[model samples]
Target: MTRAKRRWLPALLIPLALVLAVLTGSVQAGATVSLPPKTADEVLAMIARTQVRAFSGTLQQTAELGLPDIPSSTPGVTPGAGTALEFLAGSHTARVFVGDPTKARLQIMDAMAERDLIVNGKDAWFYNSADNSATHLQAPKPGAPTETLPSKPAMPTPEALANRFLAAVDAGTEVTVGEASSVAGRSAYRLSLAPKDPGTLVASVSIDVDSETGFPLGVHVQAKNQADPAYSLAFTDLSLTAPDPGLFQFTPPAGSTVTTKVLPARLTPVPDADSSPKAPSPHGTRVSGEGWGSIVMLPAAAVPAGLTSNPQISQVLQSVSGGRALTSSLVSVLILDDGRVLAGLVPLERLQSAAAAQ
Candidate 1:
């Protein structure tokens, strides 16, 4: 495959992956219940010492990012991208079973169809019932390096998202504990993180931590000027017990088209001796800011030409002064005519300014 084709999948998957990272689990608010009052530092410590791991649960994700409604399947557009856009605009439910770090399964329930991601040891399978297609990937040999799937998103658990945010707590962020609440029928302490910078599109982030186990039960990200959460993922039902091992085993249906790939032990780099030292290489990515206002810039060569030419993508992007932009409640993406793409959890103006500087 050409470099452009290879880069296209990851480029298009970025937005969807961001959305999916915050998408999962459904919240069930119950009567206000009081838990032991703990300081922010104490709660942070609790999260750091969490030991619960194996569990099975039902997750629901919802987004109200002000994105235009797009069909799951668009003519002439890549099928995966179209489907990802559809998920970005709507709510989805999935069953998640995590037995350990290497054994897990996510079954996304779609209307009359289901998409599954099963990871068993070093073997992983992604199957889409709507298309009856499956992709199997095997990890590189022991003691060797590993590779990532460009097209797949490692749908995060609420605990994982909470840890990510907690790890980034800094002087620019304010951490506080809100009222105790309920999530997935369990009592949880509400931990809120608010950015001190007004320039960020994010208003605040709220995490519901299980009162007993310290496991994060839900995550809600609010955007500035948006009353509803830009994205929410929480469990409506949860089980602490380990799931059946059978859930991790997956077999493709009969007659299904299966593509199998064994990841390379090490990725070999192509030498580019003629590349200019002053200019960013097409494969190189750079960040243009910090904290919540950060903008990720992809070099023009890194962007796939097909992404810009896709009719479906164009329909959602509006013509701005310097480029076409996909503006949502919490994030903004700018696709310059020069093919470089910039995205961040900031305003379109921030992206425009970054592009102009480039």
Candidate 2:
């Protein structure tokens, strides 16, 4: 893909991915259980101290984000956009296997076709059965970081999603422990995070932490004023034992077209307390504000020119004063006439103001 084409992928997927990470199946509520109580701080500490490195589980995701359904067969719709819409509106099921820090696999089961993402040591592959295509990426070293593949929409595991929310815990958020519950047949404590800022579209987020292993088995995100969760991902079945080593192996079937790429030795690293903040990109992409109300700004040069003209995208965006907007229960995206794109959990007015200020 060309640079312009690659740039559109993240801009289009990020908003949806932020809300859709983690696959799901049928909705299943665990039975109520009685367990020893722990303070919010203790539960957070437990999650931080978790030692789990390998497991296999069946994950189910459900979203009631109130997004309009866009069929995959729609004319002028790209496969990527179609898949993103499919994930944004309904329930999905996937089997996940993790052997270690460097080995993992996710099988997204569709009715007629299946999508697979496998990461083994420094090698990663994405396969889409619907089109009989595969993309292979090899890193320079065994521990090199892998970039997100554009071929398929990959969702995170519950443990991965839990870590993301936990990292944002601050004075702007209220943390508490809810009632004890059972998830995947294991006793767990419910850790709740409520944003103090009422301006955020998110109302609260709850995570179920395993009592014995301290691993997260589920994550539920509730949107403000919504009766159901805007997004929920949980394991319907779980096992701590490592999966079969053979599961991580992948080979493109006969007649499948395979694309190969070699990744660099190092990728961008997450900044830590001791590290200096990185400078903004040449494209002028930066985040403004803080906490739950923060907004992401991408200058005109960063946004793909054809986004607004795409039929599938145009169907969901409504015209506003200065641009087109896509709004969901948890996120809002604004595409200005000037070609800039602004998105966040904040309201549309917030994005408009940010655009005007620029």
Candidate 3:
């Protein structure tokens, strides 16, 4: 547990297993995966046509985190942050950028930690300069959008988070085919899926299939059972045939200050904090009640105006690069690369009901 404390231990436990990938993405570790022998329904229908093609490479990732049940006042196990994913495959749109590229959600929550997400397509932007805030989420045109998807507690459809990050393979899942490995050099086949109800998932993956240009190179996921760790995104150096809508345009680096909000989070119910489990948190540790960073982030905009965004009110911000502490929750909100704003407190009925709902 040393990679910056396993990158803030999955942003304080994927805020309740961001749809529970804690260990639910499935890959069955009993080791018996070997395929090219076909049949299990033609290897699960060629692993359901693997996707995200139209490549333009550069996706480097590393993880060793698995907080099975942290609750000793959190913070301190090590092994964190080594994620550097980059994407650019087009034709429906995909131009996702993540952490360390001008503050790509640093401070440990890999894949854009302290906020800063701009997923094109159904349009999604989550910018939080520590609470000066910004949100503009639409996400719902393929079918099903009654709103309310804070991190998928019981909502699945957007084609199931776009086929669980592109590995497809559905029949209710249970594959396991491994034994052909190569990764970035192609020549792959390592099918894994194990959601016989491991709560819903804790592993799901598909990789390499060019026994002769059958397409599909790599893909992975691990969620649900907590420490079910395994997150991969790759394109190698692609060009199958797609990309160039001006590469999904997002222009905004000149004076960089644009705001919009709405997605999974966006609450407005307050009053409570300072409940005193000996109270502390924005890093002082010793916490109780709400989880995640446990609270802190202020340099002005001391979060209180009818304060919503809760599970227990944990959206500490204060960003825009002049002062820090861009914390998270409400399905992540760390935008200016969250680091520094922690002067903790979190009970007293959720801080007097979020300061009397601000």
Candidate 4:
């Protein structure tokens, strides 16, 4: 949830969050709990206050996507998971963000018999192997508007839903029983949930609770996409502890193409525009990208409009180390180093102070 890029994938595939949910529930068989179904409102209440000090795990996302007649101007509409990351979490410690691209990190799919997309924070100078580009513009202020998953879906924020999911389970949302099944090689209980609202991106999810621990041993999100098929996620290798602190940091190698952060032609000189956040670019290009694994957003919107993209994004990145995003609605870009810009849509001053954590 704390990841700046945290978001839901399309219906064809399950959003990345399911991996987090399975890890939170059902620890070991020895640590099982009784279940009494709960409701949406009730579930929300419990998640709000749960203390999550640290987390780490392997995540799996598979989806069958539905594409529109026209290309989507939004995220999650894609038929495939846009990108996936392996993480090691901590409250105050750093977590390595692995970029396992089926295309970039996922590149292994081309070589290995059983494709393995694996990138480690400790061994990821590979980010610079690709052509990196960004636009230089004044950082925007905070209070920008981001359209929800569906253009009209009224889903709650991760912050809002985190506590709710737990609360709903504690309160017992109506749960129905299903036949036994083997998921990821374990006997588990299958629960079918009839959502009160079909409009939910997730109409039904099959939660595989470990028969031994009473906890979720494996979870699956089966999305319904007519436009694109093959969107669903099955997450294996779950853990509830923090990963190595080194996973979150990055250092671009020498001889990389550090392009300039350019501003869009549409947004250069607005006199009365409200605070706008530039869409931050990725550390890697679209053909391939590298995930920071763990993300901590510093509000740049609060800073003075003087904060523009690194005048020479290439020079800044080469001078420094690590990678980040510099984006806007018109041109969302990712910077590979801290000196690189992380795009937002707010005005520079407003976005600079978007958060106090920075």
Candidate 5:
């Protein structure tokens, strides 16, 4: 793996389709042991510890979300896999180092190449060795109550995935604790959640937390009516000590192409807002619904050429009425004839409903 590639892969790949897939059962570790079980109350308490903050370790990601057999064109482009098309439907490993909330490095290891995401405060860089390209972003200001990075549906790291599940534990969820287990040679507790909303396709989501630090060691998400996890991310090895500060810094190698993008400033509310009729915001891509059943809507004009021009993608689209609807065990996406795309963990009928409502 090149140093540049090590700085960008995790941020891009970890949140793609079925990025939540994880291995089931316990990893065989030496010496049998026992640990205390956690009650629902205790699990709730651990969920509140969202700022466990820093850790360094190796992450194993399994993505078998039942994605279609997407054909690859360029070295890193795979239509319909989102930005993580390069990592679609496979097993991969990456090294993660987080020194604090704003500084971290994730290096994904591949058999022939590597990629990395490196962030220090509001500066971030992504490099892919397979393509010899580096992307630089002037991240939106950090710590602003309203600031957010722009992306279709921002991908979250494994640590952030823990927080995502915790945030989903509302009145619509059923919570419980699983058996005590070991992860990365440390005692851990399993917390599980099942959505009560019939609109969602997720069967359940489970998190394994390190008993000592309250950090999530693994996450398993099962799709509705499926026997196996749709996606998961787990730590096979970990260390809680602070990582070296230098690990978060980055410099592109000579001969690598570099591109830069700056996020737009967030809009601020104006005074006397009620005095004037508000203008309808221009139509664009946005997500509807919430959590597991959430649907991403992309206006046809906004979709890239890869989605419309590819023959395989075209076949998938023309095979069914109302454009096209494709599904895997965990996810379903509907492309409407009007040039809009809807996707989520819900059934195709749900996506169709969302499109009709729009």
Candidate 6:
């Protein structure tokens, strides 16, 4: 994958996965509340304090976005199962440890191999056990204020999803508290958020937060008219103590190919602008409005060769004219016939408006 795509794909998926990652196992519906659920205002207050600076846990992520039939890996495939694209359609498990924002580690367990992202201070290491390869990326110097990076974007984590959506708290959102529940054997409070905008496809989102420290234990997203969550992530096992420091250290296995990248900070910063680049995003993503009504413009060229070559992709393409619209409860994506891809939390019409302008 291109470095550009690699940089943004994770960020794009992580948050949406909180809202779109669909899991298969039955989520125990009934909760025996050890303590009564908190009020909405109380839950909101707890969210702010739930910044887990040190913790280790095993998280399960499931994606049931009702996406198009995509490709998977075979036995002899080199970059076999668990490719990033495959993350959008199945279930996966991850081992996560966070010492702080700059010190964290995530290990994705696959069928026969795994991928590890280790961040320590300003240096980040991405190691793929499948290929025994590593990518070393240097984040901006500590205390630097620049927002954009020339080489790669910031690494993403499940915790960031909690902060991202919670930061959107405003008059446009309706917050409430659901029944108390259990996650990873710990008691948690269910906090639900629903956009007041009728145009949004998101029906509602509920996050289960640890009652003790307030860290998010699980996130569930429900789409309009859907009974089950379109995406979900929850911990099957968790610990509040710090992770071993050695987990954040990496030397790259012997004979492993290592690629080094230096990220240059952006000259000017625009808030909430789309970071992903496509054919038409020559100057980066152009964002309109904010919060619930925001739309992102992503003009692109013709269909990418990678997509056209895949029979399943081609068949899906044949089902559409110039573009295709995919919708979940919280987001909408418009893939234009011109190869441009527009996405946002707004309705299909909003995305069409952005594409029409391009």
Q: Estimate TM-scores for all models.
A: 0.82, 0.82, 0.24, 0.33, 0.75, 0.75
Candidate 2 on 2-107: residue-level lDDT in tens?
1110011112234332322324433434887888888887888899899988899898878788887654422212234335556667777889888867778888
Off by over 4 Å in 6: 1-30, 69-84, 140-158, 264-284, 299-330, 337-340
**How do the residues 1-358 of candidate 4 rate in per-residue lDDT, one tens digit apiece?**
1112222112211122221111111111122344455443333233333443333333343322222122111221111112211110110111112222110122111111221112332121222122332111121223433211111111111222222222223111244555555544445555544333322333344455544444443333333332321222232443434545554334443653333322111211211112222223231201111111112232333221323332322221222124433321111223333433333212223223332223
In terms of lDDT, the best-performing candidate is 2
Best-to-worst ranking by lDDT: 2, 1, 5, 6, 3, 4
lDDT of 6: 0.59
> Which is better, 2 or 6, measured by lDDT?
2
Q: Encode model 3's per-residue lDDT on 148-256: one tens digit a residue.
A: 4333221111112323333223334466665666544555555554434332223444444433354544444554444534444443433444544453344444444
Q: Which stretches of candidate 4 lie over 4 Å from their true place?
A: 1-53, 66-174, 177-191, 196-203, 208-219, 223-230, 259-358
lDDT for each candidate structure? 0.69, 0.70, 0.32, 0.27, 0.61, 0.59
lDDT-better candidate, 1 vs 4? 1
Minimum summed lDDT over a 10-residue window in model 3 is located at 82-91
Give candidate 5 misplaced runs (Cα > 4 Å): 1-33, 68-81, 139-155, 264-318
lDDT of 2 at 53: 85
lDDT tens per residue, model 5, 1-358: 0111011111112233222211121122223347776687776577566456677888776766666544333343311334444344566678888786677777777678777777677677777788888878675556645455433222234556766565555566777887777878888778888878888777888788777777777887777777767777777898888989998889998988888855434323221222322222234555565444556666775555455555654533434567777666666767777777777767788888878887
Enumerate clash totals for all models, in the order shown.
3, 5, 83, 101, 16, 13
CA error at residue 2 for candidate 2, angstroms: 45
**Which is the better candidate, 2 or 4, if ranked by TM-score?**
2
Tens-place lDDT per residue, model 6, 105-180, is: 7777777887777768767677777778887867566676643222222333345556556655557778888888
Comparing candidate 1 with candidate 6, which one achieves the higher TM-score? 1
